[model samples]
Target: MEGGKRGDEAGPSSEKLGELSEKLNEVCHVGEDEEDEDEDHRSNGVAAGFVPGPLVSLKEQIEKDKDDDSLRRWKQKLLGCLESDSDGQMEPEVKFHSISIVSDDFGEINTPLPVDENQIGRVLFTLKEGSEYRLKLTFSVLHNIVSGLTYSNTVWKGGLQVDQSKGMLGTFAPNREPYEHTLEEETTPSGVLARGLYSARLKFEDDDKRCYMELKYSFEIKRQS
Candidate 1:
């Protein structure tokens, strides 16, 4: 009788486990149908399906779902962030971690500081056709206080501008590419790429007990003349 009663108690829990299992599977699905070539992609586009990459063995929570509004809302919010505009502006407090990039042979900026005007005579480079240069950034959080929207899984971006005098540069953040396979694995941003002097600035703001480290780096692009 005890065994039968235990089985009766376990039935609903087993069903709940099944539901959570399905939800987890759904979250793991990133990217889209490859046959649908209408989609444009720069990196492996398969990683967009979850909140946290390698979300640490979700196992399954059964009883919690019956009244877990917090978990449900969290799940919905995460999916919304991922599905929202990838090219749109990000919220404040989104801290950028690091910036690393390389320059072309014609390129030359190596130091964190921009090169002197006189040094421009030496640093000038171009991109090698079909070769992929990388720019990546690690980050903590990005959220719009007004809307409470948060951006996730960002990569280091390129096209940065420097004020030189003010030591300010154009905002750079994760671009939507790569990480498709690394879904939820916070990809790195690409660095300023061109045939001249360049530098990138990283900024960060913190919330939710997450500490952010913002670092900046600059690389010179050169071409062998």
Candidate 2:
């Protein structure tokens, strides 16, 4: 009779223990799934922080193309300046950095002045054909001023007028803002190009042609070279 009672008690205890084991397994499975989701979320966050290699390459390529385009346009402008004008009557208004007149062959005015009255006599002074003895006149636009405006500058050398302009700006227009002008012309001692004390009378004029802000500058014309 004791053995029968003990068997009944064992059957109830075994059933309770099996139920507890199943509950513990379910809890462990749920915890493992949650941990896997957290790990996946961390991997996704890391990927989002990094830019793709292809996208970075594309951005670099775009910048290079833009730089190339700018360089090409600049080259075109320089080539155009060296070419003759389409009308064949206008002077090529080249860009310069400073204001001075110098000879290509004899060097600058400070070297040694050319003594020949008809220096390089064989080479005639003609705008159509170039000459070895050339005058490079460089000047820049004054700051705080706009284009399409005329500035007066009367230049005298050897008591003869070299530059007498009612509108010194002429028909030339600036290629860009803060432009400088370089005038390269075949020169001779004849007319007003003879060497002497050079003087210039510069003035800015109003719309009514009234001159103001008058300035005078003088430079020696003797080049020893």
Candidate 3:
């Protein structure tokens, strides 16, 4: 009788173990499915637009069809006003000089690159709610050509994402002069509820998905006095 009772107890224990094992498998499969979905989403997002071309050395490109006068002129025109003494560069380099917020009400507020350490975590600037503004970026390309350079900005309020933007800066060749790009105009959301501090991340990347820079900053929207 004791042996039979022990077997009966063992039967329920084994059943519980089996139930736990099935639950664990289900959880693992769910996690894997979510990961796969995320991968597919990322792949589809990139494939939908702006596929980067293969990296080619600037020297090789300059050497191609050297004898063709028309092609040479065309290349020169395409690559605007390159430095006469510029050496053949193997890879591209980008240097961000500054960013400016331009608005009719506020004029312009310029922030220099590599923000000061003391200013880190501090509010960079404040904007009046409902005001329209445009962002201007000044940068320079050095060495080789930069292809499909793009900009992205994401803003969050109270740990929740509120806005996102992406803009294509286009391909650029090394030049002595800096390039200035003004983004499309945007109006700040207006409301008592919208007046608050917000955190943002700005990123610059190329067609290869190589990140040139990423900056995190905070700003505030205030009610107009």
- Output the number of the lDDT-best candidate: 3
TM-score of each: 0.25, 0.29, 0.73
Question: Between 1 and 2, whose TM-score is larger?
Answer: 2
User: Over 4 Å off in model 2, which ranges?
Assistant: 1-98, 106-147, 157-163, 166-177, 184-188, 191-195, 204-215, 222-225
* Cα lDDT for residue 123, candidate 3: 82
Poorest 10 consecutive residues by lDDT, candidate 2: 23-32
Candidate 3 lDDT over residue span 83-102, tens digit each: 45346655678999998889
Tell me how far the alpha carbon of residue 44 in candidate 1 is from the true structure, in angstroms, after superposition.
Answer: 36
Q: Candidate 1: which stretches are off by over 4 Å?
A: 1-92, 102-131, 142-195, 199-218
Q: RMSD, each candidate, Å?
A: 15.3, 36.4, 22.6
lDDT of 2: 0.34
Candidate 3 Cα misplacement greater than 4 A, ranges: 1-53, 81-86
Q: How accurate is candidate 3 locally (lDDT)?
A: 0.68
